[model samples]
Target chain A: MLAALAFVAGWPLARTIWFGFTDASLGSLADAEWVGFANYLEWFDYGDGEGEWFGLLADAAWWEAVRNTLFFALVTVSIETALGMVVALVLNARFPLRGLVRAGVLVPWAIPTIVSAKMWAWMLNDQFGIINDLGVRLGLLAAPVAWVASADTALIAVMIVDIWKTTPFMALLILAGLQMIPEDIYEAARIDGVNPLLVFWKVTLPLVAPAILVAIVFRALDALRVFDIVYVLTPNNASTTTMSVFAQQNLFQFDQFAYGSAASTALFLVIGLVTLGYLRLARLDLGN
Target chain B: MRRAVGLAKRIGFWALVALILFVSLFPFYYAILTSLETGTAIFEPNYFPEVFDLRNYAQVLGQGSFPRNVLNSILVATATVAISLFLGVTAAFALARIPFRGRKLLLLTVLSVSMFPQIAVLAGLFEMMRFLGLYNTLGSLILSYLIFTLPFTVWVLTTFMRDLPIEIEEAAIVDGAGPWDIVRRVFLPLMGPALAATGLLAFIQAWNEFLFALTFVASNETRTVPVAIALISGASSQETPWGPIMAASVIVTAPLIVLVMIFQRRIAAGLTTGGVKG
Candidate 1:
């Protein structure tokens, strides 16, 4: 029964994957055309006169979306993982008002992503924003800058907001992992004259490897699928278009239903591959 | 020398922790600070709070769709939690405790579904919503949001269910208890924490959901907090009002913060234990 309920819950996912291979369109299901491999074929198009797969493979825009999505995922996940680990280490230590501070740290995580994006968008506004005020005051820049208007800074601004909101989640997960490490291991390491760094590298690292992998893998998958932040922050800004945003653009905004489904199917494949890699690294025995 | 090193580590740790907290909180604090300051007061050229006023909060709360949206969000999230939990717990119990063929394949399917991208289903889901005559309704968003929450609830609850001792359940069976009775009497009480944790996860996921809500609901009555604030485009070509947005943002965030603050340890344990495989 539990499995059934889970299945019902996940039926939408199956519906998504199944429909991706079809020529489903905005029209009714009766009007749905079955076009096997046609959607996938469109993913590789290069806009050539040949109208063949050869031309499709050279599509720069598709490649750019892939590159941008992967780059964003890699940078954001790596930075958040590193910073989150540091936060975990620091917060793991006993201190005054520790509980209070621990709870306070979740403020960012609790804020909705859209609201966070909008708030940061306001702060990063070029003209009357306080970020420019502070940046100029602190001598970080010679003049006030509009952070979201330019291609160079648009992606970075989105990344900054995401990092701000999600790093606490990373920290919280790592902190939970940290707490599970018995204090005696560190004591033994200290008694053996192991420096904290070596103790971390040898003792803590191996012990916490599974948890860290889980956190990073989850965060990475989520980051790769990022849509809401980029969509709300830089809608139609082309430069900040991640794969999901690109898919949405093709589907809803542009009304290119087939093309959008193709892009979404590609994203599914990429995420599926990542999830496979994660399962392998974490040794999660799906018991296949 | 040893004492000095220990003291330094403590101080260093506290300072670093404080710095992290500040950076984590600065934007929200600044938002609330800016919201409290009158429009011109924000131009005073400093990060400090100038004159505190409730005008922004009042304006957003009383004069906009924010309060109504909050109620809509609460209703949608609460309904989502109830329905997902009921179905998820039942399914989890069946999967975890019941002996049935194809269970392994079923479990794998559940896991895969849980991880599949929502976008993959977006077009189909949108079509389904329209077909079912649920488009632009709270029911539409609630059902759609389940695509994310249900698999998680079932997966996490199964894990929790699997960990519970079966001997007590068997003893109850010896007392001639039926499956429903066993679930109600023997298991439900024992699974309180698991249920609470899963329900909390479901609620938060629903509350913070944006994409489906954005796509599915097209009316003010159905818009959730995230979508409401996200799509808060001002009238005409005027800019987004940061003060009201922040005020609304703060209002929506306050409850979640309180939830985390009260359930800090439980939530942390829930996330780590729920996600990580042994």
Candidate 2:
């Protein structure tokens, strides 16, 4: 029964891997052409009459998508981690309405990603957006800016929405880690006349390092494979496209199923490496 | 003097923390603000509304496919939660107590599978869904969602099951209770918190899922809340009715917020435990 259950959990994923290397259309199973590495190679330019090595190197679109993905992951995850730890540490401290505050923080997280993206998109509209209105009124800008319409602001706009939607999740996880540290340990440090900064660095940081790593790993993996926010926020725009968006465009919008599968397979490996890195770093011991 | 200094530092730390929380929640506040405003008022280059109207909700709820989407979302999410928990709890018991061979390898493989990005399997799953004639059905969406939810559920529940006392289960077994009986009478009551937490996690994940739902379900009748709200912004290419879209976003998100509020502590505990298991 356990084996059967595990099989159910894993069979679809294994099938996914198999489909990546084949030119399988969604329309039929009998038409799958076994094209080994053709899809992967096609990640580089495979245009008609193209030279081999130079053409591959000149695939700027794929590189731009890669760059945008990495930039999104790096910026959003770093900001979220710093801000989340602070929120976690604060929630760890005693206060009235602590439960309410904690719950309030999770509201964005619980809100569907697509919903929040739409909400942010509406708020950032150039003509009637509250953000633009506030920006002009507060002297932040001279005129309404098309935050999601243009390439320059589209990526940043998407990042802000992503960070707003996910920081609560990071904070909650880190807060759990913060609570796991014994109060007596901190009290002991205080008795030794340790400064606040030293106590946090020497005592809290090292002890909570595992949780922080876990949080980053999970967030990074999700961010690397992000799709819905960018898709909903900036459709029909090239500037804000991440790898997932690019792959999705091929899969759904363009019906390039084989190529999209290959792209998704590449993403799987990137995230798999990160997960393995975290498992080693955290010395994560699973099993009875 | 030292006590005074300590008190001041604590106050400052809390204030800083409160500031972060405020920033984190500011967009949601803005969402509610925009949702409550009239389109004419919102387009007037005004940051604050002079008058509030619930007309956006009335308009969106009455016409814009919100109600049908909500019903579809609830049905899909509830079914996903139920199926994931049922399978996960049973499998977790077998792993935690059965002393079976390959248990360790199986656990590791399940964890790794849980970590694998869903997109990697998108094309394959899509093909399979099409093959099985389940494409664009809520059933297909639920099954695809199980790929992520089940493994994590089993893993997390295994951790929780391990923490339960062994003697209680052993005694039940000695009394000639079968596996089903032992699970029902001995463990089910004890698993309320774990079940609730895991079920809630699975529900929220299914509720918030977008990519698969977007790719698979093309019609408005089968579309979930996330997809509904997402497509709402495109009343036209040149004109998006912000008031109705924001209103729909809020209405769709309200239930999720309630779920989080009621189960905040359990959700936090479950998340930490799942992380540890991973």
Candidate 3:
């Protein structure tokens, strides 16, 4: 199985890294020539202060994508974590039909990302969408707003969809952490007549910190590499393009294989470094 | 005042839960609602299911290549789950029980492989598929899906297997059982729930996968449900067939919802274990 993984994943990764440094394109791999750091250089090049910056680093579109991804990750993960904690806390409380409610929460998470994207795309449609109608009825919008079509709101629309689909995943993970907390801790705090807010701050937060950290890190990585939601919801929308989308567009749509590989490699490195940073901060040991 | 505060708090809690449930399910509920509306009925923003129409579902199923796409999705997902489980179980045993050298490194390597963005492998895998004459075939999808499926299956299954009692295996070995015998007779039965959980998760992953399914396959006949639904066009270029798209989305999503409902506990166990351990 390790050998299989190596052949399927490792070999391809190695090839991508190699191809990133070459002049490879579709259907011409055999005749592709080696170029040392040319692709990397081209990605970093800043044109003489005249024409639009062509290099990916200086390119406005790429920077917008990077900013969008970062903003998306920051906003969504934070909100999801907060909302997940609240939902987990509520579920942890003694309530009737809790199991049914818990199962209900997983519905969104179970729905395929693409399906949800399409669902939201339609729901956010400016014309004949229930959301717009509701907004109009409730006086939320002066008129029906094109949620996903305009550049100003496209990223926000995508973020809303992502948060909707993934907050359940976050809630469940945090709920698992919540379940691990012994009742005695809270019982003792209650006996001491500690305020609930104080108890949560002093006990619950510290105990669930590791789980929340893990959840946040994982979700952040996922958001950083987001493709399906953005691609399906806002295809080729420069404001909403992520690293994965950009790389895929270059490789498949535009057929700039080498340049695409370079972009992909850059994404890989970014994710790897962030993961390493997280591991170090969390002090997580995988050997066990 | 205290009783008032308590009542307010109680109301607040239920209201929050209701909001969560509504937000979680409203899209799918609306999708169903929209799917049941035919013609210009969809154009009217009616929240309630006023009319029941099966035409959209029939349109999606009876129309060109949608049924084939659904079949292809089922075929690829099932094959992926079967192969991933078979390999994952055996690999988990080796990694968990066999006491091999570099086991830790191998496990870490497996974990890392899953983290490599799929696009990083797109160029390479595309070349490889073409080389092996597997490009645009279900075989390409099965193989590529393994890139994501195998790693998590092996990781989670290994964690589960390591928790099983060693005495059971020892007792089997005392009865003159070989490794394969131990696996088939002793371990397989015990692993039913774990296998089901991991297999279901793998199936979902394969079903939901889009990047590879979009990039690797070309023909409409070969496309998976996601690509099919994504490419589902309207009567003309100017308009999108939202009705058919929602119908197809519901068709493809129904099985997943059923599976998740049936196996919610096990799925939760698998996810938490995988996340905490990894």
Cα lDDT of model 1 overall?
A: 0.79
* Best-performing candidate as measured by DockQ: 3
lDDT by residue (B1-278, candidate 2, tens digit) is 99999999878877775776676566677777777878567666444456689998999889856899999999999998898898898888999998979999989777767666767777767777777898889988888787778878988899999999999988988999999998889899999989999888988888888888987788989999888877775546777778788788788777778888899998888887775211
Runs off by more than 4 Å, candidate 2: A1-9, A25-29, A42-58, A277-288, B1-11, B45-49, B233-235, B276-278
Model 2 accuracy (lDDT, Cα): 0.80
For all predictions in the order shown, the interface RMSD in Å is: 3.3, 3.0, 2.3
| Candidate 3 CAPRI level | medium
Considering the two chains of model 1, state its CAPRI-style docking category: medium
User: Could you tell me the TM-score of candidate 1?
Assistant: 0.91
In candidate 3, stretches whose alpha carbon ends up further than 4 angstroms from where it belongs are: A42-55, A284-288, B1-3, B276-278
lDDT of each residue in A204-238, candidate 1, tens digit only: 87777667777887788788889889988988886
lDDT of 2 at A174: 92
Candidate order by decreasing DockQ: 3, 2, 1
Candidate 3 C-alpha error for residue B83, in Å = 0.9
* lDDT-sorted candidate list, best first: 3, 2, 1
TM-score of chain B of each: 0.94, 0.93, 0.97
